[model samples]
Target chain A: MFEAEVLSGGFSNPAQDSARAFRACLDAMARPGRIQQIAGAVPPAPLSPAAGAILLTLADATTPIFIAKSHDTEAVRRWIAFHCSAPVVAASDADFAIGTWDALQPVSQFAIGTAEYPDRSATLIVECEDISAPTATLSGPGIETTQTAYLPNLDAFVANSAQFPLGFDCYFTAGNQLSALPRSTKVEAL
Target chain B: MTDQAYNFAYLDEATKRMIRRALLKGLAIPGYQVPFASREMPMPYGWGTGGVQVTAACLTPEDTLKVIDQGADDTTNAVSIRKFFERTAQVQTSETTAEATVIQTRHRIPEVALTEGQILVYQVPIPEPLRFLEPRESETRRMHALEEYGLMHVKLYEDIARHGAIATSYAYPVKVEGRYVMDPSPIPKFDNPKLGGNAAIQLFGAGREQRIYALPPYTDVVSLDFEDHPFDPSKADHACDLCGSEVSYLDEVITDDKGSRIFVCSDTSYCTTRQDEGHTGRLSPEGEAA
Candidate 1:
């Protein structure tokens, strides 16, 4: 064990902290475009607190994670290996992927899942420099009337909506703040 | 303080992780039933094991849990589940519908309107809307994938042909987000309208079926019906005899062997609150003896 690198950043109390983190994630996902704050992880550089916390809460041996080129570093891999035993795989085969908006390039590379099993699609954990303000309109399940959030790429999400019931779900993380955009959301330019 | 005899919420950390992942996928899918590794509970399968496990997964130490059975908080299933969490999870349990963060229900959503922050966990006996029509799981799965809900429409049409109306009073099926036709557990058709555009997240779990599904807040949930027939949310015409509340779902209760009966609000908590506010019906104090 790289005791200092691995053990220092994870949840201090696995049970309680993970529970709290999960609820935050659930609320964020259920109510797309709503920003939330998740605590209890101080992972190595390139991984935000919310992203690290999510990996601890959701990733396990069964999930194949993809670390995008921007955040792919020796320290990040070590932290991931120590905290989550998930196998790292290519973007297309990943159950979950982590990186900034651009680093996760050719977003089409990820699985959009099959018609028979749409839930099998990948969930991208996006690391953002800033995730504030609302720029585009979003209406769908979870959203009351219509919500507005600043998505890095509006056309990508609009295209994603066309694949409704099929596209990949995403979580945008900046520092400790998190927000989500599921496939069900109807994204539009404001 | 709570006893440390069991893990927090009575589930190991790994199990919670698996459930959490499934819940996220379910939310993302919106009314699509996601399969999970359902765990055994101390209670029987019918006794809300699904709802209990869901609550356990969703709960935090800060949450206030409430359990309801057929709209009443005092029923055996409700009491047992509430006590189980109170003992094992050491979380605060509330009887008031407004104060509860997580409400686990066997049947019947509370009469009170839920807000955005609240969550409702439904104990579902059958997670599949087409389970009865198509006995084969594989075919039903394919049908769901292909969005072929003709069988359900046919089933409803047959009901209209026989009973002059769609006779499904309970376990009403609803289409979520115009995508998936979902089973809203065993809630009466009267509560079907409330399922759509709700402020709270609705989670349905079937431990026996090993499935979990969800509807995010304000999701479109349309009860299956024909244009001419229309989905009706009818209830007993009588008001609650004790509380004088005519809007709530009523249960017909027999008074004695003389075949005397009276109607009361199925939601005991709501009825009590109404009564406390001095709302009274035909069976108020002076008129009760008659």
Candidate 2:
């Protein structure tokens, strides 16, 4: 049953791929702003290596995920459902959402968490074509000194960070490359 | 070889390592609450998941384990917790205090004095001493960094002013060493005095709050009280019906429908041991079974 669910599609060996993806999650969370490339699963079209890696890493029955796009096809849904059993919900009610930034509409709809519990915020896994070094400089608890990421938009991230420990954390996935921006990070536009 | 079917002690090794590292830091600091990324267990919050996690990390094959809830070994929660570790870690279980190397408890410390080589793990529902005062984590983090604990002091003073005695009954707050004012779980103030100057190491875990704190062997733990008001670990001024012990903490039991109260020792094992030796209070009828 585990093989039929986790190994059916493109990933011939699900357990090994899941382990690699989990390592990427640990690295992303531990280092805050550091980008780690994660590749293994050969999921169908829209679901790239980085996106597939994330689904394997964080998605489980406990986590609520949302997929928002016409491109969110049945093959992608079947693979995730069989492997993780993660319930799919609307964008506003998701703990983690996957899609283009535009389809995820009004990022404020997701949970920013309460004043008492900031860690309750949602984590967005946005699919991108390529991730490069943006002009914005980043520094926080996890960073050794300072680093930069080419973000989809500086204004959205700057506004998000202003809330401090009360905003959504994001993971930008392009092909097998993934980078993160925790709420604690300070993003300054150049 | 590890049982590939289950993770180490039923927790992933990475998670155990993270908790183990946090435990070491907590021990070294002595009373400071270290923040950890606590995981969700099959059990509900407000239960003893925190204590379970700590026990899981510290358990070795050679260690004999004991678990208690409200000081009773046979309590349902305690029994369930013991069974979980037994199945996962395959460690030996014990009811005797002296024979056990690790004891996990909720709401009360054991009556038997723990010596060196023993570890007492407290199941904490909430580990923050200042959580009620400041609701926000951002504010509490700053408060801890600055050592601004006047709010806690003011709260205690107000309790005396209103009730003519400190109103806090269990889970009393205490200062560890000289740095961190820690919550001693929900054990009534009566057990507060036993916290400090003990030969055993004490650990506190609050899973929902994602916190782990400790008090090393012989560390100073002062119960929060004013100079004039003073702290008192007060209990019902009655002796145990089965054990004749007056100093042990008591659990108030209602014997009759009219609300007649009988004070019994909270430590069930200790009481049973004493009863076996023919100890009985004046209230217990002669030749009555324990």
Candidate that would win on TM-score: 1
lDDT: worst 10-residue window of model 2 chain B: B21-30
Model 1: CA > 4 A from native: A1-3, B286-290
Candidate 1 clashes between residue pairs 3 or more apart in a chain or in different chains: none
lDDT for residue A86 in candidate 2, whole number 0-100: 80
TM of chain B vs. native, candidate 1: 0.97
B114-222, model 2: which lDDT tens digit per residue?
Answer: 8866888999998888999999877886776566789999998899889898899988889875556788998989999999877677888888988887775556688
Stretches off by above 4 angstroms in model 2 are A1-190, B1-4, B283-290
Per-prediction DockQ, in order? 0.90, 0.02
**Which 10-residue window of candidate 2 chain A scores lowest in summed lDDT?**
A10-19
- Measured by TM-score, how close is model 2 to the native structure? 0.60
Docking class of 2: incorrect
- lDDT score, candidate 2, position B143: 75
Considering just the first chain, candidate 2 attains a TM-score of: 0.87
Local accuracy of candidate 2 as per-residue lDDT tens digits, A30-64: 34555787876666668777887777656677667
